[model samples]
Target: MKLAYFYRNLNQGGIQKMIVNAANYFVEQGNDVSVVLMIPGGEYVSLLDPRIKLIYFRSLKKSRLFFSFSDILKREKFDVLFTATPSLNTFTVIGRLMARVKTKIVISERNNTVVFFKNSALTLSKLTFLSIPLLYRFADAIVAVSKGLGQSLQKVALIPANKIHVIYNPAWSPELEKQAGLPVQHEWLNDDTVPVLITVGRLVDAKNHALLIDAIALLSKKREVRLIIIGEGPLREKLQSQINSLNLQDCISLEGFKLNPVSWMSKANLFVLSSDYEGFGNVLVEALAAGLTIVSTDCDYGPAEILEDRYGFLVPIGQVNALSEQINYALDHPIDRDLLISRAREFSVNQIMQHYQSLFSTLIS
Candidate 1:
């Protein structure tokens, strides 16, 4: 099978990581795989399997990129074209139609698009939301990362219920286990005396890291705790000010992005996710793989489904007191690490990719 995956870039993002994992896995299975990008070069570019082909366009403009994408489809005539997110998927669908190609298009929804753009003031967000129902129905298959997310997309976009499929992200791989064992140099993690809480995500508005900072400040009064926030984004300065205002500089560390956050997760005492919403929380699975205890906001779609109330603790979103209380409770009452590890295995790349392979086979046949 010749599989072509499309995305904006191979940047440090959950969706990008998942695409790279799928491409790598499919290539290893003796299928021809290619990753097509609108922008060239990203953090994950180095991580791509050498056996897989990578094609990128120089045009930053979406209109120009759409034409280039159509050219590729007309030339390559891939067996399956798999892409994700709203805007990029829209581009792929329109481009395929323009090319008049027979490529089977599969677009995966990685977030709650309705919730994602609901409060946004950007014209682009409005356009993307409008484009969802209009363009997405044209695809061969539509994948939502969680059941809750799938239902939401169907409701807002009025996509046929039969057209949408719920597929969990390939959040775990054997390579992650190897990376988890690697040594981390963080002082707080090294110190067994003080408990370390780690959260990995872009410092964006949706992540609600401000809530995490407040929760840590409250936790600090009761006990000794340190938080390391991995990943960098536009909200760094704002987050830093919040930390300073609360005098949580000592307790909270904005560690920025790391290539291998699994190593840090493996060493941390507890993992936290304070997002306002998610399509699926990939870090929760990565934390489980590291055998770390978790306390995540009971956000729509992902965390509840992943933790299932048994593997970890979930608190209502944006409640500083509730989040703090739960964090304290989770630290005091530790769940079985092996149980978490067992749950993480369900999301292993090999297992999830088999489902994808089945979908592709059915589409192309």
Candidate 2:
């Protein structure tokens, strides 16, 4: 199979990682795999497997215009086209109309469509969402990262229930294991007296970083807990101000985007995700893989589904007090470290690749 994977960029995100993993797996399995990045380029370009060819469609912006992608589709003959994100849904739909390649197009939704469009700029984002019944008409299949997200596509986007399939994001187990033996770079994290709490994601409103900060402030009053948030975004200044106001300068630290977060995850005593909503908490899986006792907000789609009673504790979303309590409880009665590692195996790269193999066979057969 000659598979063409389409994505906005090769950024350090779950969806991008999934696409890279799937494409690389397919290529290693003797299939012709190529990645077509909509955005020109970025740091994650190096992360793509050297074996898989890469192309950049510089003209493919996050807009309603379809000429650029349609032109590419007309020239490249692919057996299957796996397009990620809703922004490219319209492009794939239009490609089917204008392109010579009769590619079997499979569209995947990485985020909640309703939440994504709530503040989108493109007039067509709203229209494309409203016209999902028609936009998806050209798609061979629609893949959702979680069952909850699949149901949302059906309920909110009006996509047919029969057309949406749930496939959770593959875990970062391989990377975690690889980095486990690596030396810890941060001097502050070399100590064992203080419990380190790590959160990995963009510092955004939806991520609810403020809540995590509040919870950390609450935790600081009693215990020796150090919070390290990885990733940079618009919320940095606001979050820094909150940290200063709460006098959490010593307890909480914002270490903006590290190329490798696995080292931090491996060193951390605990991992927590406080997102208000998530399609699939990829970082939570990474944390679990790194064998950290976990605590997460019971977000709409992922945390409750991933972190069951055995693996970690889930508190109600936006409840900083409850989040703080759970963190304290986990710290006091730490879960069996080996058991957490054992549970993380369920999301290993080989296991997830096999799932993708099965889905690809089923979709293209």
Candidate 3:
């Protein structure tokens, strides 16, 4: 099978990572796999599988229509075109019209299509909401990262429920765990006695990191806890203001975008996700794989389903009081690390690869 995966960028994002993983897995299984990055001249090209061919449509941009992609697809002769993200779907739709290849286009929606629109401006949000139903009809199959996300597509986007399939993101399990010892260079975190609460994700509005800061402010009054937020984004200034206003400068530390978060995950005592909503909490799965006790907002789709039955605690979304209480509870009552690690195996790379392979085979057959 000649499989071509398309995504908006090759940057360090959940959807991009999933595409890379699926493409590499298929390549290893003796399939001709290639990844087509819609965004031209983007960094992180080296992060892709060296065995799998990579192509960048330099003319493609997020705001513009993907006119050049059709030519690329025609030349590549892909049997199957698997595209992730909404913008790329537009190109896939266009490619289907222009290309001669018998391409079965599969579109993957990585975020909640409806909830995402609500965060935008009034005019733009209305336009996006209206376009989703029309855009979804273009794909042969639509993949949602969670069942809730699929339901949203059917209910809000008005796509048929049968058109969507829920596929959860795979967790990272590094071969040979990095040593648990703290680096001597991290002078602020030299004391190994303090409980470290880490949150890893892009510092954006949907992530609702401000709620985490507020919860930390409350948690700090009673316990000697340290908060480490890993990732950088446009919201840094606003978040910094909130931290300063709450006088949480000492309690919270912003570790901007570490190349290897798995290393930090290994050293952290707890992992936290304070998002308003999530398609599938990828970081939560990573935290579980790292054997960290977890506490997450009972967000729309992913967290409750993933952290169900004592694997972790799930508080109501955006409830600062409840979030603080849960954090305090988790700090006091230690979870069985072995149990957390065991549960995480369900989303291992091998298991997820098999699931994806079966799905692709079914789709193509």
Score every model by TM-score: 0.98, 0.93, 0.92
* Candidate 3 local lDDT, 70-141, one digit each (tens): 677778888788886665665577667776567888888778766777777778556656776777687878
Relative to the true structure, candidate 3 reaches a TM of 0.92
Model 1 alpha-carbon drift over 4 Å, by segment: none
Better of 1 and 2 by lDDT: 1
Clashes of each: 1, 0, 0
Candidate 2: tens digits of C-alpha lDDT, residues 1-365: 87888877877677777777678778888998889876767666777778888877746455633666776677677877888777687668777777656778888887777877786778978887777767776788888888888888888656678878787777755667777557767766898888899999988788999999999888888887999999888999999999999998988889998767877888988889998888888788777777788999988788878878888999999898999999999888777878877777776667777866776677778
Report lDDT (Cα) of residue 104, candidate 2.
81
Clashing pairs in 3: none
Which parts of model 2 are misplaced by more than 4 Å?
58-65, 119-124
